[model samples]
Target: MPMLDAIKRHLWSIALFGIASNVLVLAPTIYLLQVYDRVLPSRSLETLSMLMMFMGIALSMMLAVDLVRHRLLSDLGRQLADRLDRLALAARIDTHARRLSRPELATAQDVAALRAFLSGSGVTAFLDMPWLVVYLGLMFLFHWSLGLIAIVSALLLVGLTLLNDRLTENSVRAYTTRQRETDQMAAQISRNAEIVTVLGMNAAMIDAWSARRCVDLDAQVKAGETSSLNRSIGKALRQVIQAVMMGAGAWLVINQFATGGVMLATTILLGKALAPVEQMLGSWKQFTEVRQAWTRLDALYRSSPERRAVELPRPTGRLTVEALAFSSYSATGPRGRMLLKGIQFVLNPGQLLVIVGASASGKSTLLRLLAGLWEPQAGTVRLDGADIAQWPREALGRFLGYVPQDVELFAGTVAANIARDPNPAAADTGAIVRAAQRAYVHETILGLPNGYETEIGESGETLSGGQRQAIALARALYGDPRLVLLDEPNANLDADGERLLNSALLQLKRDCVTVVVVTHRQSVLSIADRVMLMRNGQVDCFGTREQVEAWVKSRARPAAAPQSGEQRREAAAS
Candidate 1:
């Protein structure tokens, strides 16, 4: 009942309606039984027929009430699920800047499970439990001894329910681990379907994956059985106690120690009393599942306020990083090794800083910090002298355009991709086309069967890597961000694509945009205002192309290499 407060309004009405309907069904049956005992003692055929007809009518009413109640509960369940999903979505968006750790991702799984529980099990069974409560209470009123016995049996069943909860929690954790492995296998197969088939390892890979899955599934089945057994034990105990109580009650009446009508009523009430216990025991599994789900959803809903804290202020001007440092805890790296340390960088109007280094030199990490995707552990990234942390996420995003090495495009038309710019009016069609033209992708798109209106397949699969890169660049340019961080723009491009990239770089400089490119491509040398060389998470060298290389070769050999004017001429030639 953690988030029960949030959903109490919906729960109250659903539970009340369900309990009322269930009580009404029992009411008519109870009334008919009383009339039969009182009026049919003379044993008239017509009167007996009338009693039978009344019983039939009572049963019909019960069925109708059950149907209506079931439908309402189902609808309520769906609505609650929908509400929770919306809340989860909002929370995710609000925490978009949060780089989730493994534990955080595990918590996200709880949210997903909660959604499934609300839709499938939690709401319905929980709302219906009150009806069982009413049934049990009525039975208690008929005979105090029977009531005491049932109450004790229910307390024992509650213990079983708690045990079931423990078992279910373990199963859910194991299932989550299994699901991650399964998802990885599925993604691998999907990404390399053709390669697997060509290499003739498809069957072997599938066999391996299936073997792992089978092992996990077997463990899950065993845990399920254990849980079922626990519930069964509780149920069997309840049945045993029920039999003993009913037997004792009947024995006293048969021995002429009690009145027949009261005894008969007690017998009837005993069945009704057991009815609640039976239903409650039956619902214990679902109850445990939902309890865990509720716990998870509760945590998310509580953390939602923290996620919404990044939207208070707006940012202004180009981003600048000053003495930024970041460290990621890893098992393999040197102790206390910084991912980035004392990294001084500046991007003003019309300045292009090209960062060239080998992979794992913290290029992407630097871009992330500058883009406000993550807050720096030490030092500050500021826009116009104000810390980016003070800026609203949306406002900061508006001024910073970032395209990572792996470009992910949504499934949409070309126009949609370009207009994904938060403010499309600022990104006119002419502007989008010019950006694409500079990236050398405009004519190719115009020649497509449907031009800009054509649908791109999943993740823009219909487009080549170079084409996707060009489209992404177009999107970045559409935003007109003063600071543009491009991680390997020429990564998967042909000669023409590289030439287009060079042209785009020249235009960015001309437009007075602060552009930072992270690349290892030698061809990108011509567009660099200054090259910063990084090694071991520190800026080892910073200067013109020859100055940096001469320093590198000097470190390699004994004497310093000669700095010639010819190298400078060559730099200008490119």
Candidate 2:
């Protein structure tokens, strides 16, 4: 919409340029007429020189005007990219975090495609197309028969173009859809290349990708073949129509119904009239892509409308979750099987709560909800007595820290990864160093080739798992956050790394930073102020660490042999 609005602002000026350019283009036709009809008959060199001089000036002006139009369109495209790039990226991240968008919907690519369309000649073709009538009118002015021929030519070309579109539309859509799927599959395979390689399925993966690629390619070729054939037809038809117009003009001249000048002028006028149509037909594929891109982006933006938020005063580390419930998608509806249910809890400033659970017991889900990365299907998660949703995400993020089960870094310097992930150039070096020290990873970072400036590849693939985890901890600890959420923080840690992590947690506790962690480590459990055990989407047991440990031990022990009825009755009476 913004792009359209920008174009609308410049629409009149662009139209004016098109008008001037088309009128100036008429100079050549006018010159031929003047030379053949006036200069030759009068045998005057003065009139011919004057006409050529005016033609030269008009041609120069036309070039300048067209250049300005092109520049305006190019700048408009750049502005579109500048304005929508961040919004598309933010919407994408928000959608992924909230599980609101289909994975195949790539907003960034759509924006890029739209930009390409605006900057290229696709839009200009449509802009120049409206001037076709002026040229046709001039043809009519020459003679009625010439006008009839030009009209017929235009209609035939327009009809052919529409027919081409009708025949290829379905195949083009199929090709686009199949291409997206193929690209998604390729990205997935690349993301898991290590697993595929280790399993010796490289050939199989290649085969799978090639098969999908071929499907898309086949669809593309199917559409392209029709388009190519139709283009050839259109070109041949134009050529035939041009020859017919010339023959008719000569016949009219022989009969003394039209002059030599009129005959030559009509041909030039017909070309000007049909030029826009030909341009549009030649670039029809790009026009379709542009339309598709705009449609997708429009839909994406409409679905993810921006919201206004009021900044609230910051609060100390206190959290409350009430009647929380979450579910995974199913064949029936959005909320089907509950992953977590009735998960209520509270934490005061400086408190530490550890959650322990078996696989798929909703420990990770609970952590995600607490971190505000997900919305619960029922009830709410409140931080410092206010619903987390009430706070602007960036504002809320400042006071909270999170490290997921699978830690990830970025493709940037170590300093950038540790000191707030975005626009890291503004991140303070001293603060980065301090956070690293707090996480006990300062020495580790220093050992790198560039120390804090070391370039770590995507997801920190250049580093070992333990090193990645250690740096992620440093990132979470960077902002002096009031609440820290970590899941399996020590999963990949060496003994020293584990010791350093424990030390970091203790330091955070000492600093009155409320903490919630999900882990299976006994060492981590030993230091918790309280513990909660989750089982099958419900709280199995929750209490102080010692109490929970006792309950767990009791549950693990075998039950006493069933008592006889009389012994049970006697014990009850006692």
TM-score of each: 0.79, 0.93
Instruction: Give the Å error, residue 315, model 2.
Output: 2.8
Question: Which residue pairs collide in model 2, if any?
Answer: none
RMSD of each: 7.3, 2.6
For residues 329-446, write the lDDT of model 2, one tens digit per residue.
Answer: 5323466588999999899988899999899999999998998888778989998999987877888888898998878788888898998765678887788899899889999999
Winning candidate number (TM-score)? 2
Q: Write the per-residue lDDT of candidate 1 for residues 1-574, one digit (tens) a residue.
A: 3466776777677666666556655655465455546655766777767766877876777678666656665665666566666666666554543444222322344555555555553455555544545555755675666566656665666666667667776776576567667766777788777689999988898998898888778867776787678768867876676677667667756875544454555555545545544554555555554555565567665554422444533333355678899886432333356789998866667777888777888888887787777666788988777787776665666677778877978887887787674344555677667666755688888987798777777778898888888888877776567778899988989998898888888888887787888998888887687788988788988877778878889898977577699997997999
Q: What is the lDDT of residue 120 in candidate 1?
A: 50
Q: In model 1, which runs have C-alpha deviations exceeding 4 angstroms?
A: 22-26, 41-76, 83-141, 152-173, 188-201, 227-249, 255-264, 305-317, 329-336, 421-435, 543-557, 560-574
The true-structure Cα RMSD of candidate 1 reads 7.3
TM-score of model 1 vs. true structure? 0.79
